[model samples]
Target: MRYDFLIIGSGITGTMIARELSKYDAKTIVLEKENDAANHATSANSAIIHSGYDPDPGSLKAKLNVEGNLLYDVLEKELDIPLYNNGAFMVAHDKDEEGLLQRYYERAKTNGVPGVEILDQQQARALEKNLADDVTKVLNLPSTKVTYPWEVAIAALENAVDNGVSFAKNKQVVSITADNEGYTVKTEDGTTYHTRYVINAAGAYTEKIAKMIEKKVPYHITPRKGEYMILDRRVAGFIQRTLYPTPDEKGKGILMVPQYHGNILIGPNSEHQASLDDVSTSKGGLKIVKEGALKLAKNIPFHKNIRTFSGVRASSSHKDFYIKESLEHSGFIHVAGIDSPGLTAAPAIAKYVVDTIIRPKETLIDNKTFNPCRKAITLYDDMSAEEKSVAFQSDARYGNLVCKCERVTEGDIVRHIHRSVNADSVKAVKKRSRAGAGLCQGGYCEHQVIKILAREFGKTPLEINYFSDQSNILKNETKVKK
Candidate 1:
């Protein structure tokens, strides 16, 4: 396909850029290597929207984080995504750590982060009663928030697609060649895309994509893995706010996060990995996470843990976000090495790329039909009694419960299955409708989901995949169909 802009990777960075570009009159497409959007780091993480106090004062991470944090107020309403400004507490267990809290407070002020204050031990304990007894001080960042990171990326892409942006899944870029006319990008599936400007937002493999045109790229990416555990909603009110340890060189240490949903999240122990694909959780890593969580809060019911997962971060050697037009290639822009604060900084970074990097190079007229709003899926549990009765009258599927764990009705699953982006796989449906995200972790509802997907897509149960094309859920028919 020929286009004006071709964005690689459909993570938060790429999708946000696509949404931003959708406002302009241009032929733009986002190519995602995976079968679904946000299949990597965007899908798995702490989901914390950092308040911009941690990064170095003059760095891009700090600048964009604060700017992007402010954008969520509008984004939450426009996109219909859930956002909780429950705030965060950086606990100090000793006098030395209290000194560090003061330093962070000063940095927060310089970074233009509002509502930052230091609370005494009594004040901190009063707010979060479960806090460890040794806590000497606390840095309260009221601007810090929690959200569904994958939902943000999904909503952005959906909105962009609604406004005339094209999205192609499993289109991994294999090679790139530049010419006077434009650039040619070929994928592994033998499809080729010709575009005038290429935005490289390939996440962990961004440096490799940059090196495709230039042997000596400016930056390098080191994939670092972080492991986490999700506690059931029974522990929802166990911690009122996200709790963190003092900042360290490795990154913000393990945190106890109260998710936007009723669940609680804890233990994202950072560890550098030799390979980007190594997201397997380890006993040692979980142990580190458990130990770290205990320091900030007491009597954490580890038995309530529902799930354990990990995500690899595209940690750049430069120690900051690497966003700029390629020096060797004129039209190629690299949005790489986005790690800790990347999620929070995505909106600002997208604006910068579209306005600063791409606009000056070409004449982009406004897309008169551009629409920023993408209605959220119908959540059965959030409906009022009258609304539920009306919905049930319209579609009998609303009366059928597919996921009792999460109160996900068959109607919810079907609606998300046919969205602008569409949920083709079981995991995709789970991410969209929350059918399999509850305490049982799909154990009770997965088969029902599989059957519903099969019915909706006109495929046999055997043909349905758990996630990607290869990971089929039902291996074979146990007994021959009667």
Candidate 2:
């Protein structure tokens, strides 16, 4: 299908951009290589809405992060997503770190981040009782928040789709050629799409997409891996807000984030690598994460840890967001090198790209039928007793428990399967609903999820994949007793 704009990724940047563009009267399509949105870096991250205090002053990361942080309050109501603005603290354990906190406070003040203050030991301890004894000072950032990274991207993509934006999944852009009129993008499946504008938001592979135009792009992307550990919900209250160590050149130091879903997250030491797809958590990297996090919050319950994983950020050599219409290519826009505060900077970035970059070149009328509100799925676990009864009365599937650990019912799974961004794999369902993300880690509910997927998609259990197409769980069938 021909489109006015073709976005080459389905992460936060691309999906948010698509949602913003959908407000205009134009045909937009988002091409995602994965089976679902947020299958890559967006799925795994610290999930913190940064307060815009960490990035260097006057950089794109700083400007967009502060602006994007302010957009979430309205976005939460519009999209019906979870967001916890409990605030954040950067603790200092020594004189050097205390000086670092002072610098950070000044930087936040200069950047216009709201409610930033420097707290002494007594004040910091009053807010976070688990602060290490050696911590001398703390930088309080009241605007900091926590959110599910995948949920934001998926919700934005779904809202865009609801507002007339089309999404083509599993369509990997392999090549692009610019003609006199526009650009022609070819996918790995041999399908070609013609568009007036090509937005390069492909996380990790963004540089490669830019090079496809003329075989050379200005910047290079270094995939930096960050390892993390998720503790059980019992330890979720170990800290009242996100805790951080003093900043460094690499990125925000390993942090302790209290997830909005009543869980705890920690770690994410930066390890730069050349491989774009290396999300493997190493033994040493995770060790560094635990050691670093313990320094900020000494009372962490390490034995309560349930899951360990990693995500790769697209770090560019330029060290700032590489967002501009390619000087070499006319219609191509590069939103690359978006790391650290990229998630927090996404909304502002979308608006900036649309308002400052695209609108100046092309005139776009407002789409009159554009709707911003999206109804979220009915979660059985979060409802009251009366609400549960009403839900059960409406559907018998809600009465049947599919995942005991998370209290996920069959109705929840079925509802998520039929949405605009449906769950196609076991991992997709897990992300949509908390079916397989409980303490058991799908050990008890995986078979049920597989069966449900097979039934919903009209495919055999052998055809269903775990996450990717190549990772099919059920490979062969055995002879059953007749």
The numbered model that scores best in lDDT is 1
Residues 1-482 of candidate 1 have per-residue lDDT tens digits of 57999999999999999999999999999999887999889998899899988999999999999999999888999998889989999999888999999999999999999999999999998999999888999999999999999999999999999999999997889999997778999999999889998999999999889988876788889999999999998888999989999988888999999998878999799888889778899999999999999999999999999999999999999889999998888899999898879899999999989888887887889999998898887687799998998988988999899899889999989999998998888999999999999989999999999999899999999998876777898989988978
TM-scores vs. true structure, each candidate: 0.98, 0.98
CA lDDT, candidate 2, residue 51? 92
Q: Can you tell me which runs of candidate 1 are displaced by over 4 Å?
A: none
List residue ranges in candidate 2 displaced over 4 A: none
For model 1, what is the C-alpha lDDT against the true structure?
A: 0.92
lDDT of residue 171 for candidate 1: 84
Q: lDDT per prediction? A: 0.92, 0.90
lDDT, residue 261, candidate 2:
81
